[model samples]
Target: MENKTRTLYMIPYIGWIILFVVAPIALVVYYSFFDIHGNFTVGNYGKFFTPVYLKMAISSFWYAFLITIISLAAAYPTAYLLTKTKHKQLWLLLIIVPSWVNLLLKAYAFIGIFGAHGAANQFLDIIGIGTKQLLFTDFSFVFVSVYIFIPFMILPIFNALDNLNPSLLDATKDLGASKWTTFRRVILPLTLNGVKSGIQVVFIPSLSLFMLTRLIAGNRVITLGTAIEQHFLVTQDWGMGSTIAVFLIIAMFLIMALTGFRRRGA
Candidate 1:
C-alpha cells in the first residue's frame, strides 16, 4: 500500500514530463522523417539537407555563437562579482530582474533605441555624422540577442561562481602565482562549468528567436523560426513548416550535444 502510494506521487511528475516534453518531441520526430499528406515521407528530411536550409542553419548558429560569446563575456564577470558580494542576494536580484521583462517588449524597446530616428542615431547625428539605420540589420539582431540573454548567462554563472571556493584562489596565490595567473589557471578553469551551462542555456532558444529577429531585424534575417512561421501562416504549407521545425530541432540538438560535451570537458 505504501509503495503504491509512493508510485502514485511519482506518477504525476513522470506523467507531466511525458505529457508536455516527450509527446511533442515524439510528434516532431514522426513529422520530421515523414511526409505531409498524412503519410510517411522521408522527403522532408531529404529536402532539409539542401544548400538553402544549410545556409539558414549556419546563419542561425552564426548569430547564436555571437550572442553566446558576448553574453558570457559580459555576464560571467558580473555574475562572479555578484556571487562574491557580501550582499549577494540583492545583487543577484539586480542581475535577474531584467529577465522578467517580456522578451518581445524588450526587442521592441531596442527598436526605439536603435532605429534610424532612435536615440543612438540621433546622438550620432548630433556629432555631425550621417545617421545609420541600425534596425533591420544583422548586427541589430545579434546585439539585441546578446542583451536579452545576458541575464540567463549571469544567473547560471552566479550559481556556479557563488558556490566557488574562494580559498582555492588563496592557495594558488600562496603557490607563487600572480593575480592574473591565478585567475587564468584557477578561477577560469573552476568557472568553466558555469560558463558551459550558461552558453547552452542561452544559445539554444535564442537561435529559435523569431520576434527579436523579425521586429529589430525585419525579414532580412530568416531564422528557422521565421521560416516555419512563413510556411504555416503565410504560405499555408504545413509540411514545409513541419520540415523546417524538424531541422530546427536537429540543429538545436546538435548545439546542445556540443554544449554537453564541452561541459564534460570543462
Candidate 2:
C-alpha cells in the first residue's frame, strides 16, 4: 500500500515532465530536421559547423567558463564566511533577495548603472577620472552575467558548507595542519558536491544568456543564445534555430555529465 501511494504521488510529476519537458524536446528535434515546409534535411545541423556559428559556440563556452570560475571563486569564500556568521540566515536571505526580482528587470537596472551618462561613469567623472564606456563591452557582459547567476552559485555552496562537520576542522587542526591545508585537503573535498551543483546551475544558464548580453553588451558580445534568437525570430529560420537548440541541449547534458551530475552505472 505504501509503495502504491508513493507511485501515485509520482504520477503527476511524471506527467508534468512528459508534457512539458519531453514534448518540447521532441518538437525541437522534429523542427531541427524539417524545414518550414516540412521537408526533411540535415543542412540545418551542418550549418552549425560554419565559421560564424562555430565562433559563437566557442565564445559562449568561453564566457560561460569565465563566469563559472569567477562565481566559484567569489561564492566559495562568501559561503564560508556566512557559515561563520551569527546571522547567517539573514545574510543568506539578503543575498538571495535580488534573485527574486525578474532577471529582465535586473538587466535593465544595470543598463542605467553602466550607461555612459549613468552611475558608473558619472562616479568616475566626479573622482577626476575621465568617463569610460562601461556598457557594451566584454567586461560589462561578464560582470552582469556573474551578478545574475552568482546567487545560484552561492546557495549551493552555502548549503554544503553549512552541513559540513565541524569536528573535521578540529581534527585537522589538532594534527598541526594549517588553516589553508585543512581547507585544501578536508573542507574543500567534502563540499565539492555543492560546488558541482552550483556550477551546473550557473554555467548552463550563462551559456544561453540572451537578454543580459543584449542589454549589457549591446551586440558587442555574441553567444550561442543570441544566434538562436536571431535564427528563430529575426531571420525566421526555425530549422536552424531548432538545430542550435538541440546543440545547446546536448551541450548542457555534456556539462552535467562532466560535473558529475549524471548518474553512474545507469
Candidate 3:
C-alpha cells in the first residue's frame, strides 16, 4: 500500500520520463518493422546483415574501439598526474574548457587542421617532407574522436583518484610495497570502476558520431550513423534507418548495463 501510494505520488515525474524517453524509443521500435512502403516486415533488418552493413558495423566498432583505447591511454596518465599536483584547479579548468565548445565547431576546426593543403601539409612543406592526406582514413576519424572524448575519460578517473584517501598510499608504501606494486594492487582496483565508466562514455558516443565523420572524415568514411542518416534523410528509406538506429540504441543500452554490473561486481 505504501509503495502504491509512493508510485502514485510520482506520477508527474514518471509521466515526464515516459514522455521524453520511453515514448521516443517505442516509436523507433514501431518504425523499424515497417519499410518505405509502410508494410510490416523485417526485410530492412535482413538487408542489414548483408556484407555492406556488416562491414559498416565492423568499421564503426573498429574506429570506436580505437578511440576508446586512445582515450584511456591519454586520459589515465594525465589524470594520475593531476592527482599529484597542487594546481589541480587549473587542470580541472583546462579539461572543462574544451567541453564548452560545440561539437560541430570542434569537428569543423579539425577540418582546417587535417584537410589536404591545410596547416599540417603547410608544416610538412616547410620541412621539405611533403604532405599526407588525413581525410576519411581511420586515423583521421579515430584520432579526432579520441581528442574530443579525452575529457570524458579524464573526469571519471580524476574523481576516483581525488576521492581516494591519501593515507592509503602512504600506508602501502610504509608496508614495503613499491609505488608500482601499491598502484597495481590497491589504487588500480579502487579506480577500475571509474575507468570502466569512462571507457563506456568514450565508446558509446563515438559509435553515433555523424557530423565529425562527415566533416573531418569526408566522403571516404562511412559508419552506421552515416548509413542511418543517409537512409532516412537522403535515400528516403526510413525502415532501414530505423533498423540501424534500433541496433545502435540496443548496443548502447547493453553496454551501459554491462558497465553498471561490472561496477557493482567490483
Candidate 4:
C-alpha cells in the first residue's frame, strides 16, 4: 500500500514533467528536421552553422557572459554585506521585492526611466552630464538585465554566507590569516558552489532574453532568444526556430552539467 501510494504521488509529478518539459523538447527536435513547407529536411541544422547564425550565437554568449559577470561583481559584495547586517533577512527581502514585480512591468518601467527626457537623462542633466539617449541601447539592455538578475545572484550567495560555519572564520584568524587571505583561501572555495548556482540561474536565462532586447534594446541587439522569436513568430519558420532551440537546449544542459555540484555523499 505504501509503494502504491508513493507511485500515485509521483504520477502527477512525472506526468507534468513529461507534458511540459519532455514533450516540448521532443516536439522541437522533431520539427527541427523539417522545412517551412513541412517537408522533411536537415537543411535547418546546416543553416545554423552558417556565419550569420554563428555570429548571432557568439554575440548571444558575449551578452550573457557580461550580464553574469556584472551581476556576480555586484551581488557578491552586496550578499556578503547582507550577511553582516543585523536585519539581514529584512534587507534581503527588500532587495528581492523588486524582482517579485512582473518582468514586463519592470522592463516598461525602465523604458520611462531611461527614455529621452526621462529620469535618467534628467538626473544626468542636473549632474552636468547632459541628457543623452539612454533607451534602446546596449547600455540600457545590459543595465536592465543586470538589475533584474542581481537579486537572484544575491540570494544564493547570501544563503551560502549565512550557512557558513563561524568556527572556520575564528580558526582562520587564530592561524594569523588576514581577511583577504582567509577569503581567498577558505571562504571563496566553500562558497564557490553557491556562486556556480547563481551563475547557472542568471546566465542561462540571459541567453534566452527576448523582450528586453526588443523594448530596452530597440531590437538593436540580437541574442539567440531574439533570433528564435523572430524565426518562430515573425518569419513563421518553425524549423529554424526549433533548430535554434535545440542548440539552446544543448547549451543549457552543458551549463547545468558544469554548474551542478556533487553532494558530499550519494
Candidate 5:
C-alpha cells in the first residue's frame, strides 16, 4: 500500500516532465531533421558543422568556459569563508539578493555602470584618469555573466562546505596534515560534487545567453545562442534553430559526461 501511494504521488511529476520536458525536446528533434515544407533533410544538421557555424559554437563554448572558471574561482573562496563566518545566513542572503532582480534589468543596470560617461569612467575621470570605453566589449559581457552566475556557483559550494563533518577536519589535523595538505587531499575531494553542480548550473546557461550578449556586448559577441535567435526570429528558419538547439543540448551532455558527473558513486 505504501509503495502504491508513493507511485501515485509521483504520477503527476512524471506526467509534467513528459509533457513539458520530453515533449519539447521531441519536437526539437523532429524539426531539426525537417524543413519548413515538412520534407526530410540533413541540411540543417550539416550547417552546424560548417566553418562559420562551427566557429560560433566554439566561441560560445569558450565564453561559457571562461564564465564558469571565473565564477568557480570567486565562489569557492567566498563559500569557504562563508562556512567559517559568524553571520553566514546574512552574508548568503546578501549574496543571493541580487539574483532576485530581473535578468534584463540587471543587464540594463550594468549598461549605465559600463557606459562611456557611466559611473566607472566618471570615477576614473575624477581621479585624473581619462575615460575609457567600457561597454560593448568582451570584458563587459563576461563581467556581467560572471556577476549574474556567481550566486548559482556559490550556493552549491556553500551547501557542500556547510554539510562537511567537522570531525573529519580534526582527524586530518591530528594526522599532522598541514592546512594546505588537508584542503588539497580532503576538503577539495569532498566538495567536488558541489563544484560539479555549480559548473552545470552556470556553464549551461552561459552557453546560450542571448539577451546579455545583445544588451551588454552590443552584438559584438556572436554565440550559438545568438545564432539560434537569429534563425528562429529574424530568419524564420525553425529547422536551423531546432538544429542549433539540438547541438547545444548535446554539447551540454558531453560537458557533463566529461566532468564525470555521471560516474557511479559520484
Candidate 6:
C-alpha cells in the first residue's frame, strides 16, 4: 500500500515533467529539422558548425567562465565570513535579498548606476579619477552577473560549512597543521561538493544570459542566448533557433554530467 501511495504521489509530478519539459524539448528537436519555409532540411545544423556560430559559442563559454570564477571567488569568502557570524542566518538573508528582486529591475538599476553621469562616474570624479564611460561595457556586464550569481554560489557553500564537523578542525589544530594547510588539505576538499553545486548553478545560467547582454552589454557581447533570441524573434528563423536550442540542451546535459555527484556505494 505504501508503494502504491508513492507511485500515486509521483504521477502528478511525472506528468508535469512530461507535459512541460519533455514536450518542449521534443518540439524544439522537431522544429530543428525544418527550414524557415517549413521544408525539411539539415542545413541549420551545418550552419551552427560554421565559424560564426563557433566563435559565438567560444565567446559565450569565456564569459560564463569569467562570471563563474569571479562569483566563486567573492562568494566563498563571503560564505566563510557568514559562517563565522553570530547572526549568520540574518546576514545570509541580507545577502540573498538582492537576488529576490526581478532580473530586469536589477539590470535597469545597474544601468542607472553605471550611466555617464551616474554614481560610479561621480565617485570617480570626486576621487581625482575623471568620469569615464562605465555603462554598456564588458566590466559592467561581468560585475552585474557576479552580483546576481554570488548569492547562489554562497548558499551551498554556507550549508556545507554549517554542516561540517567542528571536531575535524580541532583534529587539524592538534596535528600542528597551519590554517593554510588545513584549508588546502581538508576544508576545501570536503566542501568541494558545495563548490561544484555552486559552479553548476552559476555557469549554466551565465552561458544563456540574454537580457543582461542586451542591456548592460549594449549588444556588444553576443552570447548564444542572444543569438537564439535574435533568430527566433527578429529573423523569424524558427528552424535555426530550434537548432541552437537543441545544441544548448546538449551543452546543458554535458555540464550536468560533468558536475553531477557520484552515487553512494557505486
- Which of the numbered candidates is closest to the native, going by highest lDDT? 4
Instruction: Give each model's whole-structure lDDT.
Output: 0.80, 0.91, 0.87, 0.95, 0.93, 0.93
lDDT of 6 by residue, 47-96 (tens): 99999999999999999999999999998998999999999999999999
> Would you give me the overall lDDT of model 1?
0.80
Task: Give me candidate 5's TM-score against the actual structure.
Answer: 0.96
**TM-score for every candidate vs. truth?**
0.89, 0.95, 0.92, 0.95, 0.96, 0.96
* Residue lDDT tens for model 3, 77-161: 9999998899997978798799889988988888888888789779988999888887777688888888889999999999998
TM-score top scorer: 6
Which consecutive 10 residues in model 4 have the weakest lDDT in total? Answer: 257-266
Per-residue lDDT of candidate 5, residues 1-266 (tens digit): 99999999999999999999999999999999987777899999888899999999999999999999999999999999998999999999999999999999999999999998899999999999889888999999999999999999999999999999999999999999999999998899899989998999999999999999899999999999999999889988899999999999998889888765576364
Tell me the number of clashing residue pairs for each predicted model: 1, 0, 0, 0, 0, 0
Give the residue spans of candidate 3 off by over 4 A.
1-9, 126-128, 263-266
Q: Any idea what lDDT model 6 has?
A: 0.93
lDDT of 6 at 244: 88
What lDDT score goes with residue 93 in model 5? Answer: 99
For residues 1-89, what per-residue lDDT tens digits would candidate 1 score against the true structure? 99999998999899999999889877766666545566777787677689988788788778887888889889977887786679999
Minimal lDDT window, size 10, model 6 = 257-266
After superposing candidate 4 on the true structure, give the runs of residues whose Cα lies further than 4 Å from its correct spot.
1-5, 261-266
Q: Write the per-residue lDDT of candidate 2 for residues 1-266, one digit (tens) a residue.
A: 99999999999999999999999999999899977676899988888899999999999999999999999999999999999999999999999999999988988898899998999999999999989999999999899888888999999999999999999899998999998999899898888889999999999998998887788898888898998898888988899999999999999999888987554341
- Off by more than 4 A, model 5: 264-266
The global Cα lDDT (0 to 1) of model 3 is 0.87
Q: Candidate 4: lDDT of 216?
A: 96
Off by over 4 Å in 6: 263-266
